[model samples]
Every structure is written in structure tokens, then in C-alpha cells.
Target: MATFEATAEAAAKNLESGRTLRELSDLFTPMAIRVAITLRIAQKIDAGRLTAEALAADTATDADVLERVLLHLVTIGVLTRNDRGEFGLTRIGEDMLVENGKAANPPWLDLNTVAGRAELAFTRLLDVARTGEVAYSAQYGTSFWDDLTRDPSSGTDFDVVMAGGMERRIREIAEAYDWGALGSVVDVGGGNGTLLTGLLHAHPRLRGTVLDRHAEPALRTFEDVGLGERATATTGSFLDPLPPGAGGYILSRIQSDWNDADVRTILSHCLEAARPHGKVIVVDEFATEEGVRCDSEDDLRMLVYYGGKERTMEQVRALAADVGLSVESLRKAADWTVMELAPAEN
Candidate 1:
């Protein structure tokens, strides 16, 4: 009886400690990730077992700094220490860094790359929460989209990162949703249109318009993916107005960048653009009946970098309802929900 009590109390303590530990872990996060990523540490190990010193020398980074980052990552299960001070990839590290591992996940680490640097701007998150404004704008002196527009390399990397995500997200959608009934679809905030390309491939008859700020890259991606004839890139802000009409709409990974009020504005944009008899599918992160289960580090990471959050399905339903869109079906797919809304079909 006494042992059972002790075990129960320990479980409770672990719950609390686990949450706190998660946030503490966030301190190293994308910086450490990008650090190793920038150095191509995992790639180094793929060749063979190697010492941190040799690895550092080869990568042109200070051995001490690389050692510290590797040790911490090992603590978190991202790297492994071999005999003789050599280093190697842990399963997690391999998933993130191995060549031929994932095509969509690589350019994500180019620190000089737009999305990579933008992700590492943890300090700028404070301004976003404090002022309820765009975090990148105040810190970098321009909007996230604007910075990409000015620099070619940054812009290309950023678009590749987004398109990479689209590669995965589109797979989830095309597999999960019935595509035959839709005549025309709009990918709101679609950049470079690769996701649309994936979706269009699944549904040959469906025409698509990409609503975003810059249409050039998306237009090119569409053409490259062989969806040029059916896909049109329309440059505009979903914040100001979404283009007139569409049978189906996609907002994949679009929300969670703003607080509640801003999300409402985005919802309103979706509402305005959606066809009366149509469906607007929002692909995003959400908590569900299973539980609020993201690791503390991931929670804090999202908080710091994006000034946004993950939400419960109830929260999403409440927000969608408030903006005159009714949740038709919420398909739980891994970490994200494919939410189908139909302007309160009544």
C-alpha cells in the first residue's frame, strides 16, 4: 500500500516536472538544431564514426562549441556518442539530417536560408506577444513576406520550405478528401503552388487559383509540376480580400500565426471566398479528445517563433463558429487536423 502511494505521487510529480522540463528544453531548440544542421553533423557521421574534434575541424567550426551542442543534443536523444569521443547519428538525428532521408526536410536547415533564419528568430517573438503585431516586421524592419521579396536566395529557400510542407500536407488531403465533386479550388496563401500541384494531380478536372502576395514562384512551381493550364496564381492578401469564388478552398498550415482576433479575420476571409455550397478546408494543428499532448518544447517553440499557438478542437470550433463557418468534419491526421467547413450549411 505504501509503495502504491509512492508511485502515484511520483506520477503526479513527473507530470509537473515533465511540463517544466519541456519548456526548459526549448532554450536550445532550433538554434542547436540549425547549428548542427548548418554544420551538416549528421551527414558527417553517415560517412563513418568520427570524433567531435575531427568533425569540428572538417566542418570549420570551433570544436568546443560543436562539442557542447552535440552533448546537449545527445541528452535529448538527437545524437549519439560512440567510443573514443567520436560522434554519430541517433535515430532522431538521422531522420532530420541523413542525405536521401527526406527531400522535403533538408533546405529547411539552411540557416542563411530564409525559412531557417526566420525560424531561429526566437527573440522577436516577444515583440509579437507584447504588441499584438507581426513579430518579423518590428524586429527585422519588414514583414516576413517583404524580406523574402527583396532577397532572391532567402525567397527561394522560403518558398522551397513551404512547398516541401505542401508536399506532405497535400498527400494528407488528396488521400483523405473526396476530390471528384470539386470543380474549382483555391489554395489560400499558397506559395509556389506545389501543394496545389499535388492536389490537382489527384483530381485532374479541378482547376485551382493560388491566392498569395507574390505569384511568380508559385506560377513557376505550377508549370514545373505540369499543372500550369489548370492552376492560376493570383497575387493578393487573404487579410484584405480573398478572390471572388471557388468550389473548394484550402488553408493548409495557414492559421496559428496570430492571436484569436487575427484568426477570426482569417476565418472571415475564408468565409468570404468560399462558395455557398462549397467546403473550405483548413489544415492546421489542434488539440483533440486524445489530449493536449505536444511536448513543452514544441509548445514554447511555437509561442516564441510565431507568436501563435496550438489549440483544442473545441477552440477551433468556437472560433470557426464565431466567424460564420461551421465545422463539418474534423479529420485527425497525425499532428494536424484537416477541418472541413461549409459556411454554416442550414
Candidate 2:
């Protein structure tokens, strides 16, 4: 049994710390917000659905439960309630109104999309820890790629998600290297040809190809962007043979999504395709232990989602060496590191 003074002292310290009962272990808050996003509560409120009844009617949810959720959101600073029982969004809530009415947050956090659905695999993280395999298959009964292949719409949604904010990065990458000198480049595993399109646009003399699992979208994008003459799309996987003899074989932001062995295989394929004279240009970020630390939540996401990882610079060099390729040039372009690899001389 503790004395009153000791109890009082501990209580005072807890209060001074301003810690919630379970702030460090809170689970309900995230799911609640996800539920709100799925229901499009913010959009409804933005459209003048001020009361719980109105929002519930719009979302086809029970009014009483929804009112409780709305109040919880108010406590969490996502919303506010007026004296007259009307609800309104706070500034934080406004960020949830996705551009073009698509998602309140990134598609991964929207809960209404496939990316969001895939994120739920994190719930099976313990299984991932024990098996050292991706949890996505355990959670969804199919691999992530297979899931996408089964549903074309979900695959398109994923491509859109990947293309988010890539425009600025593409412009920066295009200017970083003398693409015109390459004459021709292949965007290996390129989705929708966003990067290749930008490169073609930046360097009028450059010809490019988009190689991916789907050809139609990239073909349509190239035609839509009026680069049809300079760009072509082909259906293929990076795990298979790539088109040969291009001046540059680009694996833009691709290596991080594969394990080391798979990365080595991909690099070997690129080296074979780009042999003798061509360069293999890889665009990705490194996980550094020192300085400004490029490590992020994405590091863990790569692991749990796909059995992939964010590798350190040293790991990247080792992977390159394993495939008999040497990094000829390495530079930072936008948020990604561009590494130009060449086959090691005999």
C-alpha cells in the first residue's frame, strides 16, 4: 500500500506530464479517423451536412453511433460542434478534403481505396516478424501484385497514387542528367510513363520507351501528352528480358521495392541489356544512419508490404558489385539519388 503523499506526488507528476491514459498505445483514434474518411464525413460537412443525422443519412450509417464518432473527432481536433448541435471542420480536417474529391488523405490512408485496404496488412505485423515474409498475402489471401492484376481499376488507382507529386520530381530529374546525350532510354517498370513523358518533353531529341506490366495506360498517356511519335509502351516485367541496346536503361525508384537477390537479378538484366556502351540509371533514395537521415515510415512499409527494404548506400554498392556493375556516377536529384551504373571492365 502506498502513502497519501507518495500517491499525491505521482498523480501530480502524471498531470504535469499532460499524458493521456493511453496516448502511447492508442489504437482507436487512427481507426476512427479512417472510418470518418471512408464515410466522407468531411466532404459531407463541407457540403452543408451540419448535424449527425444529416451526415449519417448521407453515409447510410446509424445516426446515434455517428454522433458519438463526430464528438470523438471533435475531441481529436478534426472537427468542432456548435452550441446549436451543428458540426464543422477544423483546419486539420480541411486537409482531408482530397483534391478532385478523391481521398481525404493520401490514397493509402483513405480506407476507401485498394492502397488503403493493403495498409491494413500492418495489423498482421507479428506474423511478418516471425516469418520474415510480407503480411499482405496473409491479410488479403493474394500477393499485392496479384491483387492489382485481378482488379484493373485498383491497379490504375495505385498508379495514380504513385504519380502523385511526381511532376516536380520528374522535372528536376530530367534536368539533372543530359538526357539528350542518351539518345534513347527505356523506363523499366515505368507506370503510366510519367517520368519518361517528362524526359521526352524536356529533351526534344530524346526517344524513350515505357516497359511495364500494362501497356495501354502508358500508350494512352504518351498519345494524350502528344509524345506518341517519340515514346512507345510495351507490356513486360522487370524480372523478364528487357529491350536491348538503348543508351540508358532506367530503373527509376524501382530497386527499393525488391529484396536484395531480386534487385541483383534486376540489375544483372539491366546490365545485360545496357552492356558495352549504355548506362543503367537507377533513381532511388538511400537510408542513412547519419546526418539528415533519409529514413522514413516508408522504410517499414517497404518491408511489411512487399518483403522489400530501404537499403543504405553501402548495401546499394554491394548489390551493384554482385551484378558485375559499377556505379559510374551518383548524384542527388530531387528527393531521389540517381546512380548510373556501367558493366565492370575485364
Q: Which number leads on TM-score?
A: 2
Estimate, for each residue in 1-346, the C-alpha lDDT of model 1 and write its tens digit: 1245555975787787775766554757667877787777887878773777888888988989889988888877788887678777777788656432147355546676555656656666666668665555555666566767778666766566556545566677777776657788888888778778887888888899888778888888777777667988988887886876788778876776556887789888878877577788887766444454334445554555455666667777788899889988778656667788888854
TM-score of each: 0.68, 0.87
Q: How many clashing residue pairs appear in each of the predictions shown?
A: 1, 0
TM-score of 2: 0.87
Model 2 misplaced regions, further than 4 Å:
1-21, 100-104, 289-293
lDDT of 2 by residue, 267-311 (tens): 999999998899999887677644223555687788777778887
Number of clashing residue pairs, candidate 1: 1
The weakest ten consecutive residues by lDDT in model 2 span 288-297
